[model samples]
Target: MKYLMEFEPIIKKSSSLSPHTFSGLAGVCEYLAEPRSKEELAALFKTCHTNKIPFRILGNGCNLLVRSAVVPGVVVKLTNPAFCGFENLGNTVRMGAGASIFSAISFCSQNNMAGFETLIGIPGTIGGALLSNTSDKSGPISRFVRKIEVIDSLGIIQIRDKEEISFSDKGNDLRDPVILSVEFAFEIDKTESIVKRLRKAWISRKIQLPLGVPYAGKIFKNPRGLTAASLMEQGGFQKTKVGGAEICDRDSNYIVIHPNAVVEDVLRLIEQVKQGIRERFNVDLELEITIW
Candidate 1:
């Protein structure tokens, strides 16, 4: 606890009680460290490593699921403005990992950048999106990422080009690296055209996905050529409920929680849905959200 005292000025105790996750559900955590810069993050990691204090990186928390049991160790969140800088290159846009996807999309629209319009309604920061391989049928984030900057396990900075990385259905194939920034490549287009395309994408998103609800985007990944939402709906999970967590009436892929929904309720509901899908369709479903 001595080293933790060193971070007292920037660390929040009992972070799990009021987690930053979109689910608004969490158990108590020992600490939450908010580092304002790359240097601060490195220092925090180094100290934690030396002290053997476990830690996990947190972003916009749009795709995370915290358990009901108290989480031991620190939860590190990169939220400082220093980690949200944006730069526009001729054919590339550079952004800090802490920058939100909405901000990036807005930047692209204003700068007449094309190819990222499909990512309009997605949540989470740039780093979280990259880590989750955020994308749709059009393409994954890997498609536009030209280069990625990260802090390795040893608290050292490193950069990897697009070709150097590998992506899978689960997400980007990162080997325990903490993403610091990303440079995305895009095509230049007319500002009007970009705005039109972005607007269309947003409208489509609003129609297909649930809005004004406390729900995690998608609970399961689409398997192969089939969509998970379709499978869930076909399996009759649309009106299913486990305690206060239930499948969204509008979007079968989303799981909406009531004001008093507990973490166990959501977990049980996910299990029930997955089991039903497997039993009915003989297809295994993989979860898209990270269960912490």
Candidate 2:
């Protein structure tokens, strides 16, 4: 009860919009604390930690879908603070975990940073992406990260300078740690050429991913040799609907949502598709969305 009060004012002004996952659709968080400065972040973390308050660090909320059940914890959102910006240093660039992936790409492009352009289609903050190892053939989180700075549950800060500081295959994004920033390596290139490529990449991403609807990106990972989307299509799961969730007709890969769609709909559809794919293809599809 007391913690609720401390988290109240902050919740009233947090961002709206939640994604879908195994759980049902949920309300916007009770509170959202957007700490822009390191001091603010420290204070927020210190206060919540000291009081034993429940909280989750959030990036853009693009990859998450909290259930409709009242969320009992506080959400910490990193805003457009200077602390989240990037700076060029030698062959690498330091990126604030709070910065949006889109912004990071732009920053890199303006500064002639390459490699990260392949992540142009990914939607989420750098922190979320890093935590999730957001990438594909371009390599997940390992290709660019030179070092990760994180704050542990005990509020102790640590820096891992080498690869293998991961939590899963392609390793962890230091998920358990509250990431502050990461240093990435990039090459020098023509600004005009970089921007041109970036623009093309963005357009391509739009075509590949269903961008017009409320989605948490792809819901499943392909089993080894096959693509999840292809499996769903082969299983005839396209345009399928449960509640507010519907297999996007525009693309077999997406779960299109209506304004009234609840969390259950998406969850149901995903499960159905998964079961169907497994039964038909004999391959279990792994879910990509993190559900809580």
Candidate 3:
């Protein structure tokens, strides 16, 4: 308690805990800390770790769901501009973990970086994308990740090369490390070519993903050879609503939450959808969104 009180000046209380996640869902957290620099972040991590304080890292929050109105621990957000920067090398780019996927794509297009054009429409920060192994038809973001820099619970910084890491459909095996930055490798291409690819990726996403809704990205990952969207459609989940949370008729994979929706409503709908899918297809769907 004394250690936590020491953060009284540096950390914000519940009233100031509004997160910038895409869902626009309000949550109640005890303490929220936004470190302006890596040194500050490390100091905070050190204190929390040494004192055994529970903490959760909050990224762009695009693919997250706040399941409980009152979160139990400290929330760490790295949205400071200092944590969001990019450096261009000849064939690779060093990107801060806080940088948005859109920003990375724009940089790639402008620099004629070819490989990442497929990531244009992905939401959230680079750190979130990497942690979730975000991908589309082309590939996962892990494919472009040459190296990752992270800080451990002890606030010790380390760098892991691609070979030293493993990523799967479940997500990256990051050992719960706080990602500092990622170095991405890309091929040189004509700026026009990169632009064309970026346009195509954007158009494809606009068509397949739900639009004009307050949602937390995808609800479930595709199960093996079957698509979650099609399964939801087949399971008769379209237009299904549990309180203010409803399955998007346009895209069965997305659950749109109304302004009045509570976390329980969203969670209940998810259970119903999952149960329906299990009964019909005999497949247990894995959730893609992080329930914080």
Please give me the total number of clashing residue pairs in predicted model 3.
Answer: 0
Quantify all predictions' global Cα lDDT against the true fold: 0.83, 0.70, 0.82
In terms of lDDT, the poorest run of 10 residues in model 2 is 15-24
TM-score of 2: 0.84
Candidate that beats the other on TM-score, 1 or 2, i.e. the better one: 1
Q: lDDT tens string, model 1, 15-81?
A: 6644588878877778888887888888888788778888788888788788847677888877888
- Model 1 sits at a Cα RMSD from the real structure of 1.7
For model 1, the stretches where C-alpha displacement exceeds 4 angstroms are 16-19
List ranges where model 2 is wrong by over 4 Å: 1-25, 39-43, 46-52, 80-83, 167-175, 249-251
Error of 3 at 168 (Å): 1.9
Q: How well does each candidate superpose onto the true structure, as a TM-score?
A: 0.94, 0.84, 0.92
lDDT of 3 by residue, 46-95 (tens): 88888777778888888888877777767888788877899997667999
* Steric collisions counted per model: 0, 12, 0
| Candidate 2 C-alpha lDDT tens digits along 85-180 | 888887788898888888888788767777777678677788888776777554676667788877767676677785647544323645444788
Worst 10 residues of 3 by lDDT: 15-24
